[model samples]
Structures are given as C-alpha cells and as structure tokens.
Target chain A: MDLVLLLQRIFDALFNSAIYSSLALALVIIFRSTGLLNFAQGEMATFTAYIAFVLLAGPQPRLTGGGLAGLIPGVPFSIPLAIFGAVLCGMAAGAMTERALIRPLGGASDVALVNITIGLLLATNSLMAQWWGTGPRFFPAIFPTGAGQHFTILGARLRYSTVGVWVILLSALILLVLLLRHTKTGLAFRAVSISPSNAELVGVRVGPTLMYGWAMASGFGALAACLSANSVLLEPNMMLRVLVYAFAAATLGGLDSPKGALLGGLIIGLSQTLIPAYVPFIGFELSVLPALVAMVVILLIRPAGLFGTQRIERI
Target chain B: MSAQAPRRFTPVSVAGLIVLAGLLVAIPFLTTTTSLRQATQIVVSVLAVLGVNIATGYGGMISLGHGVFVGVGAFATGYYVGDLQLPWLLAIALGAITAGLAGALVGVPALRIRGIHLALVTLGLAIVFRPLSKRFPSITGGVSGRSIDARFDAPGWWPSDGRMASSVYRYVFCVLIVVLVLWATWNLVNSRFGRSMRALRDNHMAAAIYGIDLVAARVTTFAISAGIAGLCGALQVLLVPFVSQDKYPAQESLVIYASAVIGGLGTIWGSVLGVLARTVLGKAGSALAGYDGLGPLGEFFDLLDESAFVFGVGLIILTFLFPRGLAGLGRKNQVPK
Candidate 1:
C-alpha cells in the first residue's frame, strides 16, 4: 500500500479507537466498581443516543420544532442542550437500573446477575426498535460530516470530524482523570472499588458510589453512541456488533484497567484496519477476527491481561 | 386393611394421558402442514434447550455459544448430503458427531475458566463461528450456505399426498427421536453418574474430595450437551432441509439459554414446556400486533411486533416470580425458596 493510504488508514483507526475506548472504559468502570459484567451497557447507550436524537431531530420533535418546543417558543433548537439532557437522562437510567434491578437481586449468584443484564439487553434493544422503528434514522451530525470538511496533513487527507471525535474523547479522559484523582466523590468511588467493606467502615456511602460509577460509565457510553450514530446512522442493532468489539477491547486491555482499555482499543482498531490491507487472505468480512484472535491469545498467555493486576487466589 | 397399595395413576391422570395421546395422533390430520412445521420447530428447540439444561442446569457451567454447535451440525449435514451425496441418516449422524467433537474442544478451555470468563470464551466462539464458516467456502458453502437434496419421503404403506405425507413423516420422525432422547436423558439424569455431576455443580471442592473426576464429568457433560444440540440441528435441516450461515446466529444462543431457564432448568419435562411457551408467545405477539381494536393505545399495541421486548419482559417476570421456571408450578413437595 502507498504511504498516504496507510497513513489515512491509521487516522481512520484512531477515530475508531476513540469510540471503542469510550465503550471499553464504560465496561471497565462497571466491572471495577460493581463486580458485575453488565451485558446491557452498549444497548443502554444506544437507547440514550436515540433519546438524544429524538430531542434534537425526530419525526415528532418534542423539544426542537414541535410539541414541547411550542410551549417554549422563544428558545431556538440547540443540539448541545439536547446532548446535555440526554446525558442527564443516561445518568438517571444508570442509577435506576442499579437500584431497581441490581439492588433487588442483591446476593444472588453470578449466573442470575448475568441473566438479569442479558434481560436488560433484550429489553432495551427491542424497546428502542419499537419506539424508533427498526429502520435507520438520519442522526444529525454534531461535527461537520461533509466531504469538503477535510484538510491535507503531510500528503494525507484528514477529516475534521475525526479530529472532533478525538478532541471530545481526550477531554472526557482528562475530566475523568481529574474527577477520580482530585475530587472527594471520586475518592469514595475508588475506595469502594478497591474494598467495599473498608470503604463502608471508613464512612463512605457504598451504594451511592456504585451508582455514580454506573452513571459515569453510562454518560461516556452516551457520548460514544452519539459519535458512532453520527458516522453510521441510527439503528437498533447497531450496538450489537459494536458491543462485541468493545468486549474484545476490554478483555484485551485487562478488564479492570482504564489505561489498558484505551491501549487495547487502539491496538485492536489499528490491526483491524491494517490486517485486510496487508493480508489478502483474511478479507473485509473477517475484519473483527484479528481483535478476537488477539484477545484469546492474550487471555491464554496471561489471563489477567497485559496491564491487569494478577488476582492472587488464596485457599 | 392394614396393607397399602401403590397408587400407580389417578383416574384424572390416566384420562389426561389418553387425551394427550389422542391429540398427538390427531394433530397430523387436523392441523395444516404449516402448523406441523411449527411443531417440528418446537421439537428441535426442545432438543437444544435440553442440551443447555445438561450443561448449565445440571452441570453448573455457563455458555452463551451453544448456537455454534447447532450451526456446525447443520453445516455438517449440508456438506455430507449436498457435497458428498451421502444418505440422509448418515449425514445427520456425521453432523451430530461433528458438533460433539467441537463441544469437547470448547470443554478443554472450560477446565480452566469459570463463571464470567467461561461465558466470555463461549461467546467468543459464537462470534467467531459465523466468520469461520464464511472463510471455509468449500466446506460451509460460504455466505449463502449449502442445501440438501436428499429427501426422506413416506413409504408405500402410507396413503397420503406428497406434501402432507412428507410433513407427517417429518413430524413422526421428530417425535420418535425426541421420545428416545428424552428417555435416554432421563436415565442419565437419574443414574449414579448423574449424582456425581450434580455434586460437581453444587460444589467443586466437595465433589473433588469425594472421588469425582472433575475433568471427566465436565467434558462428558459438555460433549453430551453439544451432541444433543447437534442432533437438533440435524433434525432442523431435515425439517426445512436447508442449511445456511444465517440459519444460526450468536443471539440464538441467548434464546436457547432463556428457554432452558424458562422451562425450569435440569428437569426433563420442562424442556417441552419451554419450547411450547416460546412458540405460543411468538404466535401471540403476531396476533397482538394484528389486532386493531384499541383506539389511542393501538400505537402501544403495535409495539408487540418487537418480539425481543415481549421475551425480555417475560424472562424478567419469570426469573423474579418463579426462579425454578414454569415447570416448577403445582408439583408435590415443591419448595421454590
């Protein structure tokens, strides 16, 4: 392949990595805080994206141009306000799910917990299908999506939208770092994740911290969903495939490590892009194969993952 | 007067059994061939659900990739019959064995991983099955998949048209196989081996301390479970007599697990109930969607077209209300909690 083409592929991979990392971070946080593998994370985010879409642009635009918009006639349509509202809703949904589903079934076996999440997955996806209609809806872009919105960088054309995605992700990461390291609530959340019993004895509110973890994870998921919907149009089953990719990324990076999730996402994304280009045998249809293969191999070699702390079992 | 006799069957029970037998016999004649096809699907699902019950319900292993085994069985049948021009029965056997062997391969890893990790590994297999099948075009017939030309028509003794005869023959064939398999499974579950398997599921360290070979029990359970799934796949192709990559997807595994749970896991009769519940619920969804009587709520009714919503609600309610499942209802000495 030509140098320009390769560089462009690298750029595309970076954009994909940003989105995948966002989803992977969401998965990692939940696993770390709750000790539960939430299978519904992606679907919940997809539901949130649909909510944002409906707020900003829908057949029946309740906030923008019709329904509720008439009640407040002075304010103009704002995508930013729509996204903010959607994220807040996402946080509430996360808190509600933790309270309603997880709390009620407390002390249940792992199988039961997993099944409940699976149930949530099915419920969320199908509910979205019913409300949004299964057909792909045109989600208005938050960044410029036109072909003209690009510039040559070292003989390689780079889309401004891709740059926008990176900027959003980078900002989210910085904010997360600040929140977890410098804030009192973030310390409580971290303490709970490390040792819930200790945190509780130390006067940290364990239940609310866990809920905040879910809320933060879901908020990131909603942002990732909006990024993806901008590129791939809105559909109910869109997250199904993406969820698998995120799983591979999270597992590859180590389930409990945030930095590892980002690294794993980038590695998987780049390999997915580069493999079909270089290797003629594995075609585009099997683009996901490399990431999965990488995951399995990494897991077999080191079950704790590349950056994950080794879980020392004591008999 | 002091000697008590064993009550073999209550009159109501005997009468119910007779009624059930009569209905089974009359179904092929009374219902249209389309309905027979539905019955065939139910039997196949029962087999798959039973497979899941053996591993997850009886053996305490979580797998979300059983669909791959079924897919393998279907593809194997398609390859043998379509590509090799083999007999239908042999093809089915080969197909089932292929799935069983694949199951054993997966079981090797199950030895190390437990709980969520095992679930992840199995799910990975399901995700990989599709692309792998697509990659091997000569074996799997690529994206479009393979179709079988071998037909098992009715014998000369049966007096019926070709279509009806074929449907009845398929139904009878499925029923016979299901009965035999059910009997075998019942025996397996009740035997001394079944006790060891149950011990293993209930407690690993305790089972190991009691002279149970952990590896042997786990492998055997997986093989048997996978073999049953394979059989279901083979039977499935014979019903429609077509196999494709699209026939079995990863999400189908979730439905199979749900069916096993909904049927009341580990119980023999629950498998049938689970399939019946699934088929009945599906038909109800379509019916509910078709109804146009509700004025403003008609829009609400239209949402029933989304089968996953109904299934999700049903699963959550069933899990909360009766963790043991529909089969746990109205049994002697039954204790749910």
Candidate 2:
C-alpha cells in the first residue's frame, strides 16, 4: 500500500471525475425531461469539438478537410473563443434536433426513439470522419499543462489542469443551479420535467421548454468534450468510451437525478482509475468493463439508483 | 376460435421471387471469384439483420448487441474447427449453439430489463466485446485477430478443382444456409411458441394470463435470434478465413439494427429486403462518390460511400416516412404499439 501512489492516482482520477460529472449531468437533464436516452449525445458533443477545432485552425482545407471547412471563417480564434463558439453551435444543433427530429415523432414508441438517436449517432460519427479524417487531432488545453505546472501536496503532485477543469465544472454547475432556481424559464423547465401535461395545462410551452432542456444538455456536453479533448485527443470516436462512463455515472446516481449524476460521476471516475490500477487483468483499456458491470448490477438491484425517484407502473 | 386463412402468394410477390432467384443464379457467372465472395458475404449479413428482427420485432426485446453473438459465433466456430479438429458442418452447428447459450445468458438480465434499458445494456455489451475478446489471444487472436488454418472447400464428386470452384462452393453453401434458416425462422415465428413470443412482447401480463411461460419464451426467443446471427458469423468464416475484433465494432451492431428496422420488422421478407437495400444503397453511394463531375456536391456524395452514414440517414428517413420499413411501404400503417 504505497500511500503516495494512491494519492497520486486519486488526483489523476479527479480530472476524469469532473469530465464524467458534467457529461452525466447532460444525460440527466435530457432523461429527466424526456424518458428517452440520447444515444447521440456523445457524437453530437464530438461534432462541436470538431467545430472548435475548425474555429481554432481556421480555413485550412488541408487541416480540416473539405465539406464544411469551406464555410469556416478565415481567421483563427483563441482556444476559449473557439470553445465558446462550439458550445453555442452545439446548443443550436441540440435545439434543432429536438424540434426537427424528435418533436415530429410526437411520443413514438421506445424502438422508434432508439432508432432516431442511433441514426444520429451513426450519421454524425461518419460525417465527422468525412470532414476530419479518422486520425486523431491535437487540441490545445484550456489550462496550462507544461511540466512543473502542478501543485504538490502531501508528497503527491496534482496537475493544474485538473484543478482548472474542476473550477470550470463547479462554476458551470453553480450557474446551472442559479438558472434552474432563479430564472422563470428554469421554473418552466422544472414544471415540464415533473409533468409535461400539467405544465401544458398551466400555460407553459412544453415543447419550447423541452427544447431549452436539450440545448442546455448539449451545452454541458460540448463543454465536457472541449475540456477533455486536450487529454483524450480529438477524434470522431473520442467520446464513445467516455459516453459509457457518463452513462454509468448517470445510471448509478439515478438516471433522472442531477445531483446523483455528479455523485455517480465522482464514484465511477475514481473506480475507473483505481480498479485498473489494482486489478492486474483489467489493465487500462479494459477498465470500461467495471463501469459496465457496475451499471448492470445497479440496474438489477436498484432500478431507481441512489437519488432517482422510483417509477411506479400501473398494470 | 375459427381457423385462420392461409396466406396466399400474390402475383407481385411471385414476380419478385422470380427476379430475386434470377439475380441469385446469375451472380456467380456475372462476377469474378472476389466479387462472388463479396455478394455471398452480403447475403450472409441478412441472417444477422434477421436476428435483430426476431429479438426486436417479434420477440419484443430490443437487442442492439446482436453483433456480439455474431462475433462469438465466428470465434467459436474458428476454435471448434481449427483447434478441436472437427468437421466444418459440425463446428458451424456448435458455433451457433454456443452463441445461443451466450444469448441465453444475456437474456437472463433482459428478463428484468425491458425496452430502452435492455437496449442500453446491449449497446454496452457491444462496446465491451472487442476489448474483452482481445484478452483471449489464443481463441480470438488478440488485437490484430487470427487466421484459421483450415479452408472450407468443395468435394471432388462433380466439380472442377480450382480457386473459383471453391469460391462458388462456399457461396452456394452460404446461400443455402441463409435460405434454410429464413424458412425455418418463418415457420418458427408462425408456430405456437412463436405466438407465445409475440404474445409476451405485446403484453406480458396478458401473455402470462394466457399461460405463456414468460421466462422460457423470452430466453428462447433471444437464443434463437442470437443463434441465427451466430450462423451468419459461421458462414463469414466459411467465406473468408479470418476472425478479427476489428470486424465487430459498435457501429457494426447499429448498422445491423438499422438494416432490420429499414427492411421492416416482424416479417421474414423484411430481413432480406433490408440486406438488399443496404447492398444496393452502398453500391450506388460508392458509384456516385467516384464521379468527379459533381463538384462541391461530390463531398456529400463521398459521405454516401460510408455505409454507416447511409444507414443512419436511411434509418431516420424511414422512421419518419415509412415507420413500418421498406417492406411495409405499400402495406397499411398498422405499426403495433
């Protein structure tokens, strides 16, 4: 039991925990408003990350490839500006997806919803591959990540990027709380999430409210992708593995609970880092197995999760 | 209850059958051995799509991880044939059965997890499979994948001994197996057990009231569906003697599911139609992609070359325009809840 190594691992795990927490929060928002899980969330986020990449890299056809690259502005933007632009683009896309694709279905079957999302996943993934080659692209870190750019405490070095990510995550989370609690739109959103029919009866536009929810969720997802892109490397399939971890976190915290998503993210992220370190066979690549197994076990024993409301079905 | 009327083949259907049969017969002569093998591989993929149809459309379980069973089937068949020194036919059968047993294992979890959650779990399984299989290098050939030592070849009774002959032999075998399985599945879905399976899918409580063993029906439906997919995988090895993890990506599973949906679910012919649609669309996309005169539009055309993109867009369009799928286009829009 090397205490220093363990502490170091925990510090490393916190960065991922923040990533998973934000992504899980994104999942929770959508699931809370609509019963359908957005399987395309990761891909959508990845697309935004690409948008940021294009923004930062400017109109270099050689770098960004053909197609939409021709549409990007000629001047390169700073990293924060590029990320900001990407998040905005992501929010708009999310809202449009909800309005165009999902709303038209008008409360379709589970299978139909699954088909639509999966369709989006496949299309967006290939589209990214087409625009930006399947090869990994370098994304600049939002925070300084040079050697010695870390804090030492208790004989363990904590990277500045980890603290910087948490700061961003926590501030965004606080903003989310404020918006949800203080704003009228947030109240309407809460009402819609609780009961769409009732909210409609009370004069709230359930459709637009749900669209806002989707936008907000997508914004969170975009942020997660942008923040983690430096660490994970930007690619079409970058978020596929991260999506699993976030889903596990969401499920663990209770699929429909926001606070649970954050907590679940913390726990799943730590386990992801620690389990692989301790378990000889799991290694780094197969660490996803534990998160998956945990998800199955949680689904089996506790369908509602720690914080989610228990669903009552009438026969 | 009064006896139901037997379904009669319409003139249109008879014409369709004739055209399909003619195309199947002409394929070997029209193409080289390589193209013939590719055509056979496309035909074999129908079984995988059909597996999804059974589990999702007929059995009422949305299994997005049928590709896992297919991978298991291929790997297991490779092991049984190459390592165990068994005959190809016996190994193929055992391979399918092995996949069926694995499906039964997944089906156990599915008993409690229904609808979208089941879909989530299956998708997770699909993602996990490649990494999981990599751990077993001996059986799965680790990361890069292993090649089988033995080849499935034609016997000397009535055929010329050549590479083309062996290719033709494998193609015929695959087509025969696919048709046989399709016929068997059609019968099974219309049988008493099949009724129970559908009954459970429609309403498990009502099904249980009608004396259907919910557990047995659900598990068996998944098992049979997975077995069919496994058979597809076994035939894949027969066509190309390579078993690799790269072949079974999460996207592959989604594509298979998309095929099932696009072809239409709950109908045997829908499975075949789905695969046909995929083949036709892929060829058309690639041909269009190759044309340089389209200018800026060529970029969009290039996207067509990627089957995942085509299927993804197709799935969305079909979901909106023809919820019942291509097979259900002219039929009444009576999509079951």
Candidate 3:
C-alpha cells in the first residue's frame, strides 16, 4: 500500500507540475523571440481570461447552463467561440503593444525595451482594472467539469483533462521545434534571435518575425490563462504568481534556447511540487521563493541563463 | 573660474531671476488661504526635486528609491518639529544629516550594480519603506499619517496667521536650500571630478585609460547623488511638516527622472524646470493640494492611464530635439565671450 501511495504521489506531482509549465512556456516563448523580460505577459493573460468571462456573462456561466462552455441542449457552440475570441484579442493586444511601444524604439537596446515593457505592464493592468473593476469572475472549464473523470492505466488514475494538458503542450512543443527547424520563417526567426544585424543583411523580414513571436506567445498565453482560470477565477492580479514561475523556468532552461525553456518549465514544476511535499516547513508560500532565488543566482553566475551560452549584451 | 559658473544669471538672467524670486517670496502676503496652501506645496516639491537633480541629473545614476529617503527626512523633521519641538534651522540640519546616512546605506549597493537592477533594488527599498513605516507606527504614525501644523504657525515676530509673512518664511526656506545646493553642484560639476563622471559615462574603458579610478568615481558619484536625494527628501518632509510613506512612494522616482530629463540632463537649472513641469502637469503635483489623479482633461484623453507614457515620450522627444536640456540658460554666463 505504501509503495502504491508513493507512486501515486509522484504521478500527482507530475500532473500538478505540468499545469504551471503551460503558463511558463508562454513567458519563455516571448522572452526567447524578443529580448524583452516581459512582466506584462501574465497580466495580458489575465485580461483575456476576464474577457472570456465577459463573453459568457449573459448566458449560462456554468458549463451545464445555456452559456458558453455550457452543456445545455442548444448552446454547445459558445465555449469554442469564447475561446477563439480570447485568443484573437490576445494576438491583437500583443501586436498593438509592439507597434505603439516597441516598434518606435526598434533600434534601442534590450534594457530600454525591457523597461518599456515594465511601463506597459503597469499602465495596461491599471487601465484594464479600471475598465473591469477589481473582482474575480468565473471562467468555465474547457473540458468536462468532473474531477472524477479519470483514466486508470498501469494501476494509476490519470485525470483526463490533466493528461490532455500534457498532450497539448507536447504537440505544441514539437510543432514549434519543427517549424523553427524546417520553415523559412522559422529560420528567419532563428537568424534574428542570434543576430538582428546579420539577419537584416540576410534580408529576413525581422519585423514580421517579431510580430509572429508575439502572436504565438499571446495565443499560447490565452490558452494557459483560460485553463488556469478554470481552477482559479479570473482577477487582474491572476497572472502575477504565474509570471514569476515562467521567469524562473525561462531563466533555468536557458533564456535564449527554446529547448531549454521546455526543460526549464518541467524542472521548475517538479521542484515546486516535490520540494514542499518532501521537506518539512517548505509550504506553498515559500515554493516560488526557491525558484526565484535560483534564477537570480543562476543569472549572476551564468548571466545568459542556464542553457543560454550566447554573449547577449549585459544591459 | 568662469565667474563662479553660469547660474542663468548674466545681466539679463539676474534681472529675470530677481523678479521671479521676488514674486515667489511675495505670493503669501498677497494671496489668501487657498493660494498660501498651494504655494507651500509647490515650494516643498521644488526642494525635493533639487535633491533628485544631484543623483540622476548630475551623477547619471537613477535612484527611484529617493522617496524612501525623503520620507525619512520628513519623519525626522516631524519628530523634530512636532515632537521634540526644535527650531527650524536645527531641525533641517538634523533631518538632512539623518537622511543622508540612510541614503549612504542605500547607495552602497548602487555602487555595485548599475541601471535597472540597481533601480529595482532601490525601488524595492521604497516598497519596504511603506510597510516598515506602518509596522513601526510609533515612529511613523502608521496609516494615520502624522501631520503637523506647527511649521505653518509662524515664529514670534512673524505675526500669527499673517499670510504674507508665512509665505515669505516658507519661500525663504526653499530659496536658501535651492541656492545653496545649486551653487555647490555647479562647483562640483565644473571641477575635474565632474569631468571624470562624464568621462566614465561616455566610455568606461576610455575613462579607465585616462587613469581615473573607476570604482572610486562611480561610488563617490552615487554617494554624492544619494546624499543630495536624501537632502531633498528631508526638505520635502519638512516643507509640508506632514511625515508619511504615502507622501513618498516609488512613483516619485519616476517624476524625479522625468523632471531631470525635461529640465536638461546635468543642467542645474534644468532640474528646477523639470520640477516645475511635474508640479504643474502631473497628478502627484495636483495631489499636493489634495486633488487626486489628473483633472477632467486627463480623464477625457485617457491621460490618466497613460501617465508614464507622457514621460517616456517626452524623454524621447527631448533627447532628439535638444540634448542640452535647460542648459541654454547657462549660455550667456560663459564669461563675456
């Protein structure tokens, strides 16, 4: 029985780990493509989740009701439409930020861009809060609402939705890796990432690639936000904690390396679960502390992050 | 020595300043209740901005945590003015000195790190200051926010509630600090030490090549800048005689930077100009007189949401248009051709 319980504990840990990784991956995507340590990504995600709530406000908020994500006889289509609307808005928001703030100061160094993003994060969140008001609103589960809907394989009960999250992340990761590996646009992105000046010489459409990166990032961000909002209702400060995790994951995985970002997310997720469970007095409040400290220390030692070996400028 | 450094005080300049100073000093006597309160707040921020000028404007180190130090000064002044009941000059001296030490403690880390990382650390201190002030409510008066009408109560010869006399006394306080700080900064900047800071900024390696002690200059600059920020914080604390963390939050740092840039980077007079713009344009300025956020125009145009947007855009525009800042005031002071 103890042996079965240990295995169960490990499986449970992995499931919990993957959830945080989803959000972390979104942060990593933006950081890798654009050299912006975007503090706004989480807030952007929160804003979209709030929008999703607004979209389903009139109809049934619960999935069983007549609203979006509801299982009501006639209103099965609202859920997917709400999700689509959120994704589209996220993409538009990302692009608008680029044009309004980043594009003008295109030639400026990364530090300036980073500070600009910080300013954006503060300003946008405040503006959104003013519009939405300070309240947590319900966001429907994309899949089934039942926690008991689990698959028993290898004598382990696997949550259908939890398993679905992993499958979605893995598929997306593979697609991203392949696109970067195989396509011309991906190659242009790689070139720009390595050296913008050289990429300009190579005649790659760098501006569009940056926009592409932002779009993909926001799309993934929307998905992550929607899913997390299922567990925790949407609030303006919803993404603040997740942003810190993603930053830690990105930093650990190698800030500039995409593969590193994936691994970084997994490692952070595991440690977050395992450390607190295994160690006495290592509670929830302190779980993120380790990750944050580690990232800062790693950056200090390796400046480029764990897997990042490139000589990125200090500023 | 180029006739004691250009202070925007050539023959024409002197006449302009004399008239301006005359007006500022004369306002209280001429104005009624509401105007006196407004003038007092303006003068308070002016002194506060002068401290910002020393570090960011002259030293080229961004210290957003200047507000914490300002609060320290205010609290110290509050203790001296309201509690200990010391005289104004003595209270100012003790408050400035006390705040300067606090500035040095914060300045030490700045000596190690540069730019945003350092800015964040100082900003973090500002974050800490709010909670810490409240935590030690005995000293800070916590959320209640310690207020003192003692400073407003004029001394023996000033005559009680005499608006003109009260305004003159407050104006004298601002003018004395501004003149003294500006004069000292001018002397410091024109010297070889000032050249070394500029050199380091232009090219750290090249500056080192000239045999300048890079660390010493950097640390000294931070120390000096911080001390000045502390001084300003102290003055600001006393200027209103209301000591609280709400008075000096992290946002004040941004205003200081904006004012410094708008006034003219490294220009003494520019710092004052930057303060003037901030006092007049932003809500923090408006807050001095008990107004919140921007006025109607701010809301209608969404300027309320885009507060830093204005500063960020303004900095870019100013940098492109005139890298010189308000230093134009010093042009004629170049000693008769």
Candidate 4:
C-alpha cells in the first residue's frame, strides 16, 4: 500500500530475479548443446545447494567484530571454498547424469530421456529428503557484512542480497557470452549444437564436448541455486519453479539461445514481479500465471521458440 | 467367423482372462489381511498407472500430468459419493467419465503440436492442476479430503461374520474393479479402435496419412486414458474410503511413467504386472527398512531409498537395456525383438 514500501519490494524482487535468470541461462546452455529439455535440471541444482548447505555447517575460525572469521563460527572453510565444492558437486552430478544415464540411452526417443530425467528428479528429491529430513537449512549469504541490507535508493529500501544476485547474474552472463563467442570449447560446443555428427567428423570430441556442456550448465545452475538459497529457505520444493520459469524463459528467448535465456529470465522475472504488483485480478495465488501466459504466447506465435531456428520435419 | 481367419472366435485370450478374473474373485479367501491391504495398495497404484499406460505407454505420449486426472477423478468421486449421495458404482463411472473428458480437453493443444512443447504444457498442467484442486475445497474436500465408504455390499448369500466379512467384500470390490479394467482393456486393445490407437502411436504421420483422423483419434485416446485414470481414482476412493488431492501430486505422474516403463508399454498384462512390481517394491522398501526381521540383514540395507533412487536409475537402465520393458524382455526371451 505504501508507495515507498512497494517500490522497495519491487527492487527486492528484481534483485532476486538474477538467480532465476542465471539458472535460465544454464538450462539454455544444455538445450543449445543437447536439445534435451533436461527435466532434472532444477533438482541437480538442489543437490549442489544442499552440498553448499552442508559445507556451510562446517566449523568456522574465530573472529573479532571486524575480523573475517566472525560470521557464523562453524564453517571451517572460506565461503568461496565451499562454493567451489558445491560447483564441483554440481558439475560432477551433471557429468555423471550425461555419461551414465543419458549416453547409454542414446538413439532412444526424446520422451525416454525426458522421462528418465523426470525419474531422476523424483529419485534425487526423495534421497535428499531422506537425508536432510525435508527441513530448510540456513544458507550463508556471500555479501559483505553490511552490504545491500536495507539501503534506500529513491526512497526504497534495498537489501544487499538483491544487489548481490544481480551482480552475480550479470557477471556470469558476460562470462558465458565471452566463453561461447571466443573460446575454443565454446566453438566446439556451438558446432555440436549445430550438427553433432558433422562436428564429430570435423574432429570435435563431440561426446566430451557435450558432457562439458552439461557440466557448465549444471555449474551455473549451482551458482543460481546458492544465490537463491540465500534469500529463500532451501527445501526439497525450492527448485520446483526454477525449471518451469526457466523453461518458459528459455522458450520465450529461444530454446537453444543462451542470450535468449537471459532475456527470457529478466522478462519473466520482471513480469512475475510487476504483474502481481500492478494487476488486480491475478492475485498472489496465481504466482505462476505470468510465466505460463508468456510461454503460451511464445509457443503460439513462435513455436520453435523466440530465438530458435524454425524446425521443419519432412517425410 | 471361422477358426482359420482373424475374425475367428476362438476365445482363447478371453477364456484365459475369465479364468484370471475367477482367480481374482477367489483372492479374498486366500490372502491374509496384511496381504489384502498390500493388494489394495497395488490396486490404487494401478489405477494411476493405468492412466500413465494409456497416455505414455500405448500413445507414445509421456504425460507428467496424469496425476491431475487421478486427482480430478478422486475429487469427483468425493463430491458425487460424499456430497451427492450417489451409489458407489455410479460414482466411480461418473468420476472416470469426468476425468476422461478433462483429459480430452487438455489434449486439444497437443493434438496440433509435438514433442517437448506438449510435455512442457502437461508439466504445467500438473503443477497448476494441484493448486486448482486445492482452491475448489467444496468439491475437492480441500486439505482434509473426504472419506468414501459406500462399497459393493456383502452378497445376500453370505452372512456377515465381522472383520472377515468386511475385509473380504472390500478385497472383492478391488479385485472386481481391476479385473473389469483388464478385461475391458484387453477387448480395447484387440478391437479396431485399439488397433487404430496403436497405429496412431506407432506412426502418427503414417496413420494420419492413411486417414486415422488425428483430432478424433488423438483426442479420444487422451480421453480414454484420462477416463481410465479417473476410474482408478474412483476405485481407490471406494477401497480406502479416502480421497485427497495430495494423494495425487504432480510427481505421481512421474512415478506412474516409471511404473509403465518397468511393466512394459503397449500391453495389458504389462500394465498389471508393472503396477504389481511398483506397489510391491515401493511397499517392501518402506516397510522393510525398519523391519526387525532384518536385524542381521538390516546391517546390509536401506530399502526405502532403493525405490526413490532405483525408480530413476531403473528407467534410465531399462530405456537403455530393454526399451520394450518387461513384456518386451519376456517376448525377447521367448523369441526375438
């Protein structure tokens, strides 16, 4: 009701969207490489987030008020180091999934792979719930002690969590774009995307290249998971909307286009934030409405996705 | 119809099915209460799995939203029986019919599109459908859910002997519903309509080119699948006297797909067998994890996680190793793919 408070909430929403966009980018990366929808994508992110949670719970070095060690005296390792562990965990899970689960089912139908991923999702979720007991674990935020916490810009209070999310997302996006554009691995990845058989014939290690693609996607997914985990309580259901929103974003942007995921994510995040705020009929209950509407619109107008090449199936 | 041609009425298959029906009829007399309880669980699981079989197995359509159909059926049964005060049998029929019609409607967009797009839509359906069910508390019974007790009564010929009589009637109802489904599905698969359904699955383009009528065939199949799923929901409500949306979540659709795969797609017996395996494995895992008998064996075990992890790993392995499922595996051993 208060204009200042409302703007602050909107700012917070935008800040949090960076994580969703980043995850959307990860999904886009995998789709670009393998053309698989990767149903287990969000769950894979959850696995890593849980890893980060466990790592965060480790013993911490003693610190004075100004000392770096003062934050949550339990975690033995540096926050960055724990993040590294989580990233590795995410990448490894992604690789194992690609090599063990996906590769073996090669030449099978698309539905089979999707179904397998769906199964993977349930399996992973159950395993985690059994281990973690379905309770939310406190995740340590990476922002500086007083960073982005209740800073008023244009009379709106903004949290450092929001700002940190945006910064990480932008940095990751830039890194990803650069990697895809100029790097040798990126070139090979793009080649695989365009034509896997042709790329393999042209001396690209197509299999490993695809695996790397999954690793990269999952790695970014982990970052998104960690960032979002800071803001929201990380539960088994934490990543539920990640996949849906990401899929919609990726689809709207162009299923196979990384840039599309970013645009799609931002657009979705903004709409999701803005719609419920401004629109009268669509209340909080319809949280998923914006993403769903955007998706239907994109699919109807551009079935191949916003930025995807038109697919033509001939007899 | 002569014995020499396809039209021949040998009734071998039908005769075998009837005998199986008779065996199912005898199940209440043979099994313990514990076993009957387990069997009841299997029946419920199979109801949802039947929808998955219809949507995923036979149709070559992987729907992660069949849970919604089950939920819809359950809620409808709850409303019909719990509120409208309808007969048990009519409630079940109506519930299934309602879900079937809903499934047909959901299939409209899918009738035009193909692949991942269709899947995303269905996934969205599963996600949204749950909330929608929750919102309509008056019909759905909301969070608390509604209990259903009106089952086929004890026959006039048999005297009510307390616990034994009650359990027997419930078991009979469960078995009767299952056998009826199997028999109906058998006739469905062998019928021209069934063949067309298979054809549509086998080669959608070829079938369409040959005049299979894409809209009618696909939509009808989707409806039938949803209807079967609804029938399962109603049966479960009848058996357990409980119907809740939480019982059928978006994830349940995934579980059903896994069941369909393990059971083998495109076969009636496979669907039944798949449901049995799923129920047994899932139940055994949950039950035996804390079992005292496994004191010595317990050191080597954790059974519950097996279902959770194994479901996904199993699907991945089966798709790789035996794409045709258990039925296909059986057939392969008998002859060859």
Which structure among the candidates has the greatest TM-score? 2
After superposition, the stretches of candidate 4 with alpha carbons farther than 4 Å from their true spots are A1-9, A59-75, A144-148, A278-282, B1-26, B30-38, B148-160, B291-300, B303-306, B333-337
lDDT of 3 by residue, B1-337 (tens): 1222353456856775688678776776687766666666665555556665566555556665676766787777777867788877787778777777777665565554455445434544544466567665666887778776566445777655544565566656666776787778778888899888777755667888999997788767765665666566556655566767676544465555555656655566666677666555556423433444547554434534445545555555544344444544345433110
Q: Give the TM-score of candidate 3.
A: 0.71
Clashes of each: 0, 0, 6, 10
List the DockQ of the predictions in order. 0.46, 0.84, 0.15, 0.46
Off by over 4 Å in 2: A65-74, B1-6
Ranking by DockQ: 2, 1, 4, 3
- Expressed as tens digits, the lDDT of each residue in A210-287 for candidate 3 is 877787777777767876787657776667656666767777777666667777777777777767777655555456
Off by over 4 Å in 1: A1-4, A58-80, A151-153, B1-23, B137-141, B144-146, B159-163, B330-337
Q: Is the docking of candidate 1 incorrect, acceptable, medium or high quality?
A: acceptable
For candidate 1, write residues A147-179 as lDDT tens digits.
Answer: 788878888878888888889888988999899
Tens digit of per-residue lDDT, candidate 1, span B1-337: 0101113555654675587567668888887889898877776778888888888877788877888889888888877877789888898889889889989887877777777877766766776678878998877768887667777667788777676888898888888888789879878877878778788877778989999999999998898899889989988888887778876666677777777778777677667778778877878887888888878787676767766676677777777767777766644444332
Worst 10 residues of 2 chain A by lDDT: A64-73
Tens-digit per-residue lDDT, A38-89, candidate 2:
9999999999999888888876768644336557565478899989989999
lDDT of 4 by residue, A160-197 (tens): 66776777777867876798789999999889999999
lDDT per residue for candidate 2 within B1-337, as digits (tens), equals 1111126776766888899989998998888888999999999999999999999989889988999999999999999998998999999999999999999999988999899989999998999999999999999999999999889988887375666888888888888899899889888888998888888888899999999999899999999999999999998988888899999999999999999999988878889999999999999999999999999888779999998999999999999988888877766646645
Q: Report how far residue B121 has shifted in candidate 3, in Å.
A: 4.7
Which structure is stronger by TM-score: 1 or 3? Answer: 1
Reference contacts recovered by each candidate, as fractions? 0.42, 0.76, 0.02, 0.48
- Models 1 onward score TM values of 0.91, 0.97, 0.71, 0.88
